[model samples]
Target: MESVRVPLGERSYDILIGSGTLKDIGRHLKGTAFWRDSSARTAIVSNPTVYKLYGDTVYESMAEAGFEPVKVIVPDGEEYKTLLWAEHILGKLLSAKLDRSSFIVALGGGVIGDMAGFAASTYMRGIRFVQAPTTLLAQVDSSVGGKTGVNHPLGKNMIGAFWQPSLVWIDTATLGTLPKKEFIAGMAEVIKYGIIRDSEFFEFIGKNKKDILNLNSKALTRIIKRSCEIKAEVVSKDERESGLRAILNCGHTVGHAIETVTGYTRYLHGEAVAIGMHMEAHFADMPQKEVARIKRLIESYGLSTGLPKDIDEGALMAAMEIDKKALRGELRFVLPETIGSVKVLPVKKDRVLKALKRGG
Candidate 1:
């Protein structure tokens, strides 16, 4: 097992990574502050698909460690990621009689992590939560950054809070069960880390694409750990995203706009981000070769790098205008200056329109 630390002083936490860590969750949680209580309570938030596969394992593990665990299942889809679903999670949490002293265990993919963490953040004015992210996207990005929220009709993650997890326990074994499309979709965020922060990591991925596609254990462990490390380093410094953290939104600005315009169902998060990065890279001042390299990498993952032919340009612009990073109605884009470097700046509307057209 290997671990990475997100150093936030009093709120700092560790991300534990290893194969089969999920089975030992109880043993791990036993060392945390929450375990001090003899009658500790926790809600295991998951979706039906994930719960059916791993629910009993988590339940028995927590119970064995003396935690009173309750199952809280939500439907498994992006369309369900909303305030109403968040409310549904809250209602289940209340029914479970979870209190501020109680912590949440988000036990599925990105949607579950977001929903559970959002619920934990709002329940009784905030409580502790642990992330046991199953999917690759959740493991690499969503699970670690403490950016928890449900989507609004107008935008992705429109309503949420930056609620850090007490611990992020990632069991890589879960990836063995991920569907191929979602796995490929996850490569977008992993690729983003390389583009915006580490050129070497980006090269490493390109060279090892075959092994990564085959799910070689060593390759998987390396990429997953490195991805977590880069994210942890960034998040630890700018926990609230007031400054440097915005760079983490590399493809998210246009990526989210795609999601919002498509009603959150057409493309998986990473798929949309891949297309977004390909299109928005045009707004950057990077060399043409660098831009093509970015597009090629995204495409090599078997992901799309262009807009839908039927997409409405006007709606896409309106969606981008309302992105969380927008300033005074102008969208702030995190554009790559080169691989391993990026800038968060506002692109002009005409330029954005051009990029949209280019994407088409």
Candidate 2:
């Protein structure tokens, strides 16, 4: 087991990574300040699918540890990540008569974490929560950063809050049950950490691609720990994404557009990000050799590096305009300058259109 700390002063938390950590989640949450003084109550927010797999274990463990646990199951899918679902979770919280002292446990993937965290943040002007992310995408990225929210039709993660969590417990054992396509999608964010700031980690992934895909325990632990460290470091410096943190959205600008234009159902978040990185690199005129290398790496993980053939160029362009990174309605992309470095630059919409046409 390994732990990385997000040093946010009063809001600081630890991300615990290991193979069997889920079995200890009850004890871990009990150790928090929130659970120290009373019979701590927690609502385990999960999708029906995930709950079916690990619900009993989580509930039994919490009960044995003397904490009250409630199950709140939402439907599984990106389409359900909406205010409507968030309100549903809020209703559950209210029905339970959970007080401001109670915290929520987001026990599923990114969707559950985002919506549940958003609910906790807005409930009674903000409450505490813990993230027990079950998916790779959520484990390495969404669960650690404290950026929580549901999606908007205009863009992904459009309506959200910067509420930090009290703890982030990641059990690598959960990945063993992930579908192949979802696993491949997660590699996109892992690849982003390498492209944005860690060249050495990029090479490490290239060297161990086989072990990673094979689900070698050592390889999985190494990648998850390193990814969390990089994210924790970045978030500690820029907690609210005021400046340096924007770089973390390396592939997300075009990626979110792809998701919105495709109605958030066709491609997984990681898959859309893979294609986004490819198109944005092309638009930024990154080195051809590097671009090819990125595409090959992404393909090696069973992810696509190109836009959907039926994508609407007009809608794609329109989505980019509303991206959170845009400045004065201009498109701004996090362009890679080398293997380990990227810069944010604003480009013309027409130029982006030309790049999209070429990609098509």
Candidate 3:
């Protein structure tokens, strides 16, 4: 087992990563300051499909640790990640009469984690929550950062809060049950960490792509640990995305636009991100060799490298205008400087439109 600490002063928490750690969730929760509070309570927010898969084990773990958790299940899908679902979950918490001392345990993928965390942040002002991310995308990205929100019709993650989790429990064994495309989607974020900050890690991913695809325990554990560590380090320095954290949204600017234009029903978040990274790299005039390397890496993992031919370029540009990172009227993109470095540049609308029109 390995752990990374997100040092956010009072909001600090440990992200525990390992195989088969789900069974130990109870013990781990007990070690936190939240557990020390005698009035503490925990409610798990998950989807029906995921709840059927591993909810019993998680519930038992919490029960053994003295938390009589409320099992609040939400409908599954990116389309369902809306204020409506958040309100529904909040209704459950209210029905249970949970207090600030209580924390919500998000036990599914990014959708559940985002909604549950959002609900926690808004319910009766604010409360803590635990992120038990079940998907690779959530485990490596969403679960570590405090950014929580549901998708808006105009933009993705537009309505959210910077509510940190009390603890991030990552059990890699859960990946064993993840679908093939979903696993590949998660790789986009893993590669994003490499592109935005760690060139060596990018090369490492290329070298071990086979092992990672095959779910080799050592490879999966190593990548997830490294990804979390990178995110933890970034979040620690800029918990509220005041400055350095914007780089974390390397492909998200274009990626979220794609997701929104497609109505959140098309590509998975990471798949859209894979394409977004390639698109942004193209727009930034990155080296051909470097861009090719990134594309090869993405395609090799069975992910897309560009937007679908049918997507409306005009709509994509429109969606991006409403991006959370956009300041004033400019669209700021986190463009690659090299294999391991990036800069946030506010490019003109015409340039981005041309890039989208170029299409992959």
Q: What order do you get sorting by TM-score, best first?
A: 2, 1, 3
Question: What are the Cα lDDT values of the candidates?
Answer: 0.88, 0.87, 0.89
Shift in Å, residue 44, candidate 2: 1.1
Q: Superposing all C-alpha atoms, what RMSD in Å does each candidate have to the true structure?
A: 2.0, 1.9, 2.1
- Our model 3 lands, by Cα RMSD against the true structure, at 2.1
- How much is the lDDT of residue 74 in candidate 2? 93
Q: What are the per-residue Cα lDDT tens digits for candidate 2 across 50-151?
A: 998877888888877888887898999887899889999999988887788888889999999999999999988988898989999998999998989998
Candidate 2 RMSD to the correct structure: 1.9
Question: Residue by residue across 134-203, what tens digits does model 1's lDDT show?
Answer: 9999999999989999988865678999999988988888888999999999999999999999999999
| Residue 4 local lDDT, model 2 | 94
TM-score against native, each model = 0.93, 0.94, 0.93
- Evaluate residue 122 in candidate 2 and report its C-alpha lDDT on the 0 to 100 scale: 95
lDDT of 3 by residue, 1-360 (tens): 888999989998988888888888977777666676734457889999899999999999988988878899999888799999999999989998898788888999999999999999999899888899999999999988799999888656789999999889889989999999999999999999999989999999999988999899889989999999999998899888889999999988889888878877788889999999999988786788998999998888989897778899988888888888889999899999898999999898888888789895
Off by over 4 Å in 3: 31-34, 38-40, 152-155, 327-329, 348-350
- Backbone clash tally for model 2? 0
